[model samples]
Target: VNQNEHTPTGTIREFVALSVRSINFVMNAFAWIIALALLALALYLLYRWGTANYDYFEQRRVPYVLPFSAYGRMLTGRLHPVDAAGEGYRVFPEERFSGFFVFRQPGYLIHDPELIKQITIKDFDHFVDHSFNISPELDPFLGRSLFFES
Candidate 1:
């Protein structure tokens, strides 16, 4: 046999190698497409969850203090909790209660002491469960606090 002549087995092996490379290329492309699609879906879902109840106050006709001002400021550590509460309180001084959000959870800030007493005393059981959340791993003390008792 001439050295330059291709044997049947050699030709088969070369063809198999080329086929594997093509399959790998296609699979890689498909994987990337799937990954990108998943990323986009996750982002969209997050956006939806973040703003799902943004119209809570508007629907209830309650005064809304733009959460981005006080809550957002507190989250970023740019404003103290007292300052944030003060700002929220000032926004609707006349309203008996106002709707706000602590990250996506709806909350009502009762401007009247009577309403606060009613919620804390008469309707205490109804309002026991709160949506505040904290990771135990991140903050053992606060995460395990009464805020998330329910």
Candidate 2:
């Protein structure tokens, strides 16, 4: 009988066991990495969704102020100015931009596109400067412009 043929079955069993263990370890490692990647992706999506609407306000460091009254509480901050204006048109039929407060500062939330168009184009002279002490003669053309008027 050949010595190789007569080799112990115990050694063969040990080799098979070692191979299976290594395979299991590799598979588990891959599974854990995949799970971590999925978790990171989910967290990113959640962050994007949460901050989507408030991104501009966050960038400007503005505080959000909620309105009072039962109806205001129910609809406040949930509706954008455009949508709110649509509903207001049906109820109040107004054709002007509305004012609300952000912290202590007053913010004009525009609703009417035509009014906005006029303010930005035709009636720009009235709304150009927000500051009281600014002199148009000093800067002339640039000082009279709305964007840099203040």
Candidate 3:
């Protein structure tokens, strides 16, 4: 009863259906491609951010060893604390202090014993708050103590 084999306008109907399916497939692929591109961009930005502030010592003309990762030669640079201290001390013997990082935080290894004693004793009041504890979340007893307050 129909003009076409399947229906009255089966040729046009089949063509439209095929076009719609093709368009849908293309759209999905395009979306996936855009998503992947965005993910790559985000990762690139993170890497830049991590290493961005690494040259802090360089800007100030302070002596420093190249950072291992974003931590700036912290635990990763040496196996032991003493070894790490020795390395920093040996690098710039002429300099009074050497710059180091404890995960992006700048620190100094005072090579001079006199300076250390002076800072510890002469300026004890300036460094009264030695504790870096914040809240009693981990070690309930020790963290709760007033002596541990930063």
lDDT of 1 by residue, 1-150 (tens): 786789998899889999999999999999999999999999999988888888888898888778778777787999897766556588888878887776777777788999988887788787666767778888888888755643
lDDT of 3 by residue, 8-109 (tens): 478678899999999999999999999999999999998888777778999998888565732343446635655664567777888877887665566667
Which residue ranges in model 2 land beyond 4 Å of their true spot? 1-8, 58-150
Residues 24-142 of candidate 2 have per-residue lDDT tens digits of 99999999999999999999998676545544434565433332322254466665655533443443345365443432344555567887898789877777556344468887877
Per TM-score, the best of the predicted structures is 3
TM-score of each candidate structure, all chains considered together: 0.55, 0.35, 0.61
Ranking by TM-score: 3, 1, 2
Most lDDT-accurate candidate: 1
What ranges in model 1 sit over 4 Å off?
1-19, 112-150
Worst 10 residues of 1 by lDDT: 81-90
In candidate 1, position 24 carries an lDDT of: 100
Q: What C-alpha lDDT values do all the predictions have?
A: 0.81, 0.59, 0.73
